[model samples]
Each structure stands twice: as structure tokens, then as C-alpha cells.
Target: MISAPPPRPRDTTFGRSTPDAMQLSPDIPTVELTSLLGGGREAVILHNGERYRLRVTANDKLILTK
Candidate 1:
């Protein structure tokens, strides 16, 4: 006896030509360090009852610590 071929995957694109239509949100929320710190070198962020320190070093690099 001959067996049938496996079925092809369904198309979830909904007839859209470009894949960009499947994207959720086009924009992301962002915060600049200088703005968050208010021109200061360091700032503290409280998340989920934990404290995180964000700082800018003399070498112009960002550092985050718990």
C-alpha cells in the first residue's frame, strides 16, 4: 500500500506580502542615562524590591551594580 505525503505547514502571514506586518510594536521605550541621572554621575533604580546602582565612570563607560 502507498502512504500519503506529510501535510505542509499552515501560512500564518494572513496574505501579507512583507514579514513586517507580523511585528507587534514599532517603537521601544528608552531613557537616556544623563536624563535619568539628571546630569549626575550616578543614579539608583529600584526594581522588584531590589536596588540597582547605575554609574558613569571617568572613562565614559556605563556600569550597573546590584
Candidate 2:
């Protein structure tokens, strides 16, 4: 008796399993703290009617506080 051929691999070309879904946005918008704070070390960001403070710590790391 003849056996059946091996099954083909699943096609993921048109699915989110492709690498395209794992890539970052090509044109990501960014804000420079120096410009936003005008030579200061902190700035407030208003989003969706909420206030969030973005600051640089003494050790030079960023911190976001609500």
C-alpha cells in the first residue's frame, strides 16, 4: 500500500505570525524633554484629562509620576 505524502507547513505569510507585526512603527513620534521643560528637569504631560509628571532623577534616570 502507498503512504500519503508529508503534510506541508502552515502558511503564515498573511497572518500576524509574520515579522511585520513585531516591527516598531516606522515614523514614531518622540518628544525631547529639554525642549519641553525649557532647561528644566521635569515637565507635565496632559493626556485624556489626566496629569502625569515626567522627570529626570538625580542619577539621570527618567521617572513618570501621576
Candidate 3:
């Protein structure tokens, strides 16, 4: 039998990510945004118990709270 790698954490920080998604590297920290138009790409919101910010870019990018 073979054992799989450890499971990754959820997107509690911000910007919801589905299962089997690429997780953010520990070295690179995402920068969260505040507001946006229509709330599509380039939009951010508070998360993680209101301790972080999540941003989405036009290119489907994500960042943590600044």
C-alpha cells in the first residue's frame, strides 16, 4: 500500500479555493484588497474571522489582506 501526502488547509484566509487546488506557498504571502467594482476580479474582502483580506484579479488571481 501507498500513503498519500498530507492534506492542505482551506481558504479560510480569503478567496475560496476548491479541492485539488494549488495552495499558496509558505514563502509567498498573498496581499488582500479592500473594495472593487461589481466584486469580480480585482476585488477583496475580509476573512479568517475578520483578520485577513482576500482579493481577486481579472486574471483570477488572489491575495491576502494587506
RMSD of 3: 12.2
Please tell me which predicted candidate would have the highest lDDT against the true structure: 1
lDDT agreement with native, every candidate: 0.82, 0.79, 0.56
Stretches of candidate 1 off by over 4 Å are 1-26
**What tens digits encode model 3's per-residue C-alpha lDDT throughout 1-66?**
999989998657454466335566779755433334354544344565565545565676766665
RMSD (CA, angstroms), candidate 1 = 11.1
Q: Model 1, range 12-56, lDDT digits (tens) per residue?
A: 875465656566565865566678899899999999999999998
TM-score, candidate number 3: 0.25
Minimum summed lDDT over a 10-residue window in model 1 is located at 15-24
TM-score of each: 0.57, 0.57, 0.25
Clashing pairs counted in every model: 0, 0, 7
Instruction: Indicate whether candidate 1 or candidate 2 has the larger lDDT.
Output: 1
Give candidate 3 misplaced runs (Cα > 4 Å): 1-50
Clashing pairs in 3: 30-64, 31-64, 32-64, 32-65, 42-56, 42-57, 53-65
Clashes of 2: 0
